[model samples]
Target: MTEYVALLRGVNVGGVTVRSADLKALFAESGFADARTYLASGNVRFSADGEGRALKTDLERALAERFGYDAWIVLVTLAEMRAALDAFPFDASDEARQPYVVFCADPAVREELLASAEPSDEDPIAPGPGVVYWTPPKGSSVDTAFAKQLAKPRWKAVTTTRNLRTVAKICA
Candidate 1:
C-alpha cells in the first residue's frame, strides 16, 4: 500500500466539525490502513493502494457521505509531501513571515491563480511542482491579495494551503 496524506480543507471551521477519531474510523472503514490524524485541522495520513486522483475522489465521496459536507482535498504521496517540504524556497526561520505551501489540485486553476495574484517583493508567490510557495507577512496572510484570492469560492475546490511548519510536522 502507498502512503498518502489527505489535506482536507475547511474543516473544524464555519460550523463543520470533524473529530480526529471519526476521521480515523472513516479511513479504516474505507479500507485504508494505518490511518492517523495529524491535527484537528483535517490532515489525515493513511495507507492505500490506488491511483492518486481516483483515490482522492473516492475519499472525497466517502467524506461527503459520512460527514455531510462538500468535501475537498489535495491528496499527495508521502514522498511528494517530503519533497515539497524540502523544496520550500523561503526562509521558514523568519518569524516576521509565514511560509505556506498551497497545494493545487488542478493545473489550470493553479495557472489562473498565478495570473491573477501579482506577487510583490514582500509577498511572493512562486510556483513549484504541483504546488505554490507563498510567504506573506506574519499576521497579514488573510489580508494579502493572494491569500484573499485563495479564500474565494472559486479556488476552494481546487486548492488548499498549509503552513511550512505544519507540513514538516506531519512528515516527521
Candidate 2:
C-alpha cells in the first residue's frame, strides 16, 4: 500500500462544491485506506496499489460515478512528492514569492506554451521527472499577457498547481 497524493481539478471551487468529508467517505468506500483530505481544493492523500496513473484513473472514475461529474485526478507517489519538493527553485521561506509546481500529464514538455512566455531572470526548474517550477515576476502574474495565454492551455493539459508550502505539507 504505497502512499499517493491525488489532486482533483474543478471540484468544490466557485460554489460548485463537494464536502471534503463526503469525498473522504467515497474514497473509503472504494477500498482506499487511510483516506484523508487536505485544504479543500480537492487534495486527497491515500494508500493504494500499482502505478500512479492507474490509481489516478480509478480515483477519477470512482468520484465521477459517485458525484456525477468529471474529476480530473493527478496522482503523485511518495517519491515523486519528495522529488517535487526538492525541485522547487525558489526559497520556500520567501512568502512574497509564489512558488508553483505545475504537474504535467504528458511525458513531452509542451514547447509551444513554454515558448509563449516572456523570458525572465528567474529560471523555471524541473526538479522531478515530470514537474515544472516557476516563480512569476512580481506583479507580473496578474497583469501579464502571459497569464491569459497560459491559463487556457494549462487547463487543457490537465495540469494542477500547488504552492511550495502546500507541496511540502503534502509530502511531509
For this target, which candidate reaches the highest lDDT against the unseen true structure?
1
Candidate 2 per-residue lDDT, tens place, 22-133, comes to 9999988888889888887888888987777677788888888888886787677767778878866677666556677776664454344455556455544333456767
Q: Determine which window of 10 residues in candidate 2 has minimal summed lDDT.
A: 119-128
lDDT string, candidate 1, 82-164, tens digits? 98888888888988999999988867877888888879987898987778999999999999888888888899888999999
Candidate 1 local distance difference test against the native = 0.91
Task: Estimate TM-scores for all models.
Answer: 0.96, 0.83
lDDT of each: 0.91, 0.71
Q: What is the alpha-carbon lDDT of model 2 when measured against the actual structure?
A: 0.71
* Cα shift from native, residue 81, model 1 (Å): 0.9
RMSD of candidate 2 to true structure, Å: 2.7
